[model samples]
Target: MSGLPAFRPEALEQWLPRTLQNHYVDLLLRRIGMTRRRADCFVRLALYLFLKNCQSRKELPKPPLTELSFPQGWVECSCLEAADVFYSDRDRGGDRAAGMMLNKLVDLGLIQKQFDGNCTQVKFHAMPDLLKSDAKNLHISFAIDAFDPRSDAIPIANLLANNYNWLNRNNDAVTYRIANILRDWASQYTAGLRVLRRSDNQNPVGFYAFYPTKRESEVKFFEPPSRGLHLSQVADVDPFQMALAGDETCRSLFVRSWVIDSDYRQAAQMELLLDAQQTMKKMQQDFPNLWDMYTLIIHPSYAELSLALGFQKTNADPKMPLYWMYQAVDRFLKLDMQNLMRDAQSLN
Candidate 1:
């Protein structure tokens, strides 16, 4: 876990903006599982140094006398200073704390290091792709039903509040609004919600709430105010637009909320899709007029996955932060179910 001592420059603080460093550190912490507080501090300091020194430079400076192998990119830091700054004990146990953290990080494939005299050279491994399957096995279960505001609403609200950090709403306000919306959906009988849970512990991990509508008036509460003209109200001469204007023939389902927890995100997404497919099949059987489904996707990863699953970008404003993606019900149903199984195999 120790590395050869390379050149230690004096001014490393000005290398990166504080905001960028904090963002990178937050992302790294979320991605990896680190338990000990001292280890976490050491890792953060090492990451800061690595980002400031190694990643910012196009090429690393020349190493000292000894020839060393840096398979991944590396940064040189004074061991004593790093320990004093990051570890709890500055005098006696700082070095040991730093060593323990570095070794743990190495074991986790996050970094590599070498020890030389009194200094340590640490190399940062590149973050692996999101689709790269980890060894942890995931077992997700699905449930689809009409929304029950009294019981299901609170849990669903809590799930979204916990998982969707981008949403800026107070917990109580979010829960209240979600409950009211669910109550409205339940009363209308035109919408349903799906919940995904871990099979082993039966804990909820994901949710998808949707409502079918053919005209703007049918969508009572959750209609976006920015959508000035509903599909039925458009006076455009386009044949497709005209077709969608039909009273009951061209129904569209609006996705109100869709989210999955971080740990089960990969496996649970496909499960949610499959669950949606089944739910759509039931909706089609009961309603017999549903045509397509649409959702505003905020996360880049979810947008990419949506595109991979045959969703198309809608004609909504391109400048918007969230992308509006749509998929025909038939096409969605036609997507290869075997792919889900293949993807789940990787999870196991």
Candidate 2:
């Protein structure tokens, strides 16, 4: 035990998003039908253990095999200690709460676990499959659409509520503000929103919302004040202004909000990216001035995906939680279109 790395509970609490923490709890309760208390404790403790392992991996000089295979890998920890930290009763029904929760998570196909002597090794297996399935479902028709506020409002609102509620935990103020922004964009015909709906029920599973801007003032209309600090740290002058500066011939499309439900996240992300590429093409044709795309990405997973798609972070602040990333539209458009077409064909 002395040779193995120690778990840091504080790091897990600090790095994990409140929205994601709640999401895990909701998933366990809805999927496995666990009681609220048990589900909360189970998810909290399990995620802490998982993140602790991830932190340990980061400290190592070489990457773990699981990291190579999965986007978010797994961790191994002491089941007894995990239970002692999360549950009041160290033993629940003679099996212990940690053991019972681990069993339930394994049964639900959310995690894979193996006993290695006294320690338990666990890994996540859902996100990769979700991503592949989403990519398979991509179609040109669903890539971009004219958003209808009347019919699309409820589902879009629900999606936003689930993903961004942590920003304003006290009420639905964030949801309302976002709804108003979407309505404004739809009404003005200045922007569009792409939604990915479930195949069976047609309920929206994910969405990507964005709008174009030519002036620095326009950036403020899209982003909240809380995000301004990160943007300020990244640029001595206004970053958005700098991107648009001396480019009288082009405009920047600001990616305001993007999210996918936990169950279909990876697939939704692929679909969203595919749709965004198509949308860019359409925007280029309709609005020839559209020359670049920029966004302030807060989530690490989103930042990783954006970087993979050729977005470069502008901010030099090593400590900033958010990233201001951008990509030139015209320079990459031709190659991007070719790749997108190839990807679409492969999916077919």
Candidate 3:
């Protein structure tokens, strides 16, 4: 039998690009190392609803349009409610096993979750992977104002290869797994990559994974991290974006598998870090409510380089288990009142 009408006639093809539709079908069959058909169906359902309400030329709304109104019959049958309906329709299975499929969809960048007031709403963007077409080399560009030499900002593949080599040699299976997880996770957030070649002799390095510091704040974890020892509270984080922590606490912007050629290691890595830091600060400056800067993770191969650059380890765990470091820039500058207070105290 033909598949049930997944969406209203107007939305079926309009919601997803032809390339994305083909990609989704491929992802369903192979699972991209993690996805499923049911989840794909659910995402399709979300796509239908989102297209029915949202216009795709603009960015997908983080919380979706707050004013959105769902048709009564549509709401009752919506895939946004799929989790509830799917679980109830089937026997209660293991925790999250039901939503495991949804998680995979999120991993693949087909859907995202957002909080609207007290209720949670999911938004679907059927955009294909931003960094498609793996190549032997790539060239990446960064914000002109934010460029630096000592940053963990490079193509994802280079980052992965560096980490994979380091972890494999060290026999750290966990780090390897975490690296894999992060690669997949970053894929969802990537916007686009444009290759900019430096030299014909040198192969293109890799594409930049642009995480717009302004577009990621609503993600649950980006909330101000706890004021733990060694952790500094920052006040300039961009509203739309913050880095992902290797650990669950979200204190560090985990940088995994970052590799550059031996010759350019110092220049390339440092440039990326400095750029990321400056860009982050600029974001924070624009959005005073957000924090300024966070730590990063690199392969142990870069540990010596990081230490030389003043990145200290927060833990002694030999596993080197994604260590956390901290950095902060003073958010408040002395104003007339503070200067007056300082003057009075100094006189006393």
> What TM-score would candidate 3 get against the native?
0.31
lDDT for each residue of candidate 1 in 179-287, tens digit (9 for 90 to 100): 5555655665534567676666655667776666655433432334234222112223311121122246547776656777655564555557777788878777655
Model 2: per-residue Cα lDDT over 1-348, one tens digit each: 223333343333444555665655544443212445655555556555554555566743231222112325546656665565455443453226568767655544456778878667777776445434434554422233556687776778767666543334444254565566567566654344777776666667777766556555445534543454321132233333222223345477777667776666533445566677777777666557776677776544355356546678775335545557778886555545335433432330
TM-scores for all predictions:
0.51, 0.51, 0.31
The residue-by-residue lDDT of candidate 3 on 1-348, one tens digit each, is 012243443334454554565455443332222224453455455554554343323434442222222221222123334444234345553335535555545544445655555544455552322213111223532222212222223333344455445334543343344334334434543322222223543343432333323323423223332311110112233233333322123222322223444333322443444444444454343345443333344333344334433445553333443454433333221113223322322320
Task: Name the regions of candidate 3 deviating beyond 4 angstroms.
Answer: 1-155, 169-257, 266-270, 285-287, 292-298, 318-322, 329-348
Name the candidate that leads on lDDT: 2
lDDT, ranked from best to worst = 2, 1, 3
Against the true structure, candidate 2 reaches a TM-score of: 0.51
Model 2 residue 65 distance off true place after TM-score fit, in angstroms:
21
| Residue 342 displacement (Å), model 1 | 5.7
Better of 2 and 3 by TM-score: 2
Give the number of colliding residue pairs in candidate 3: 27
- Which window of ten consecutive residues has the lowest lDDT sum in model 3? 225-234
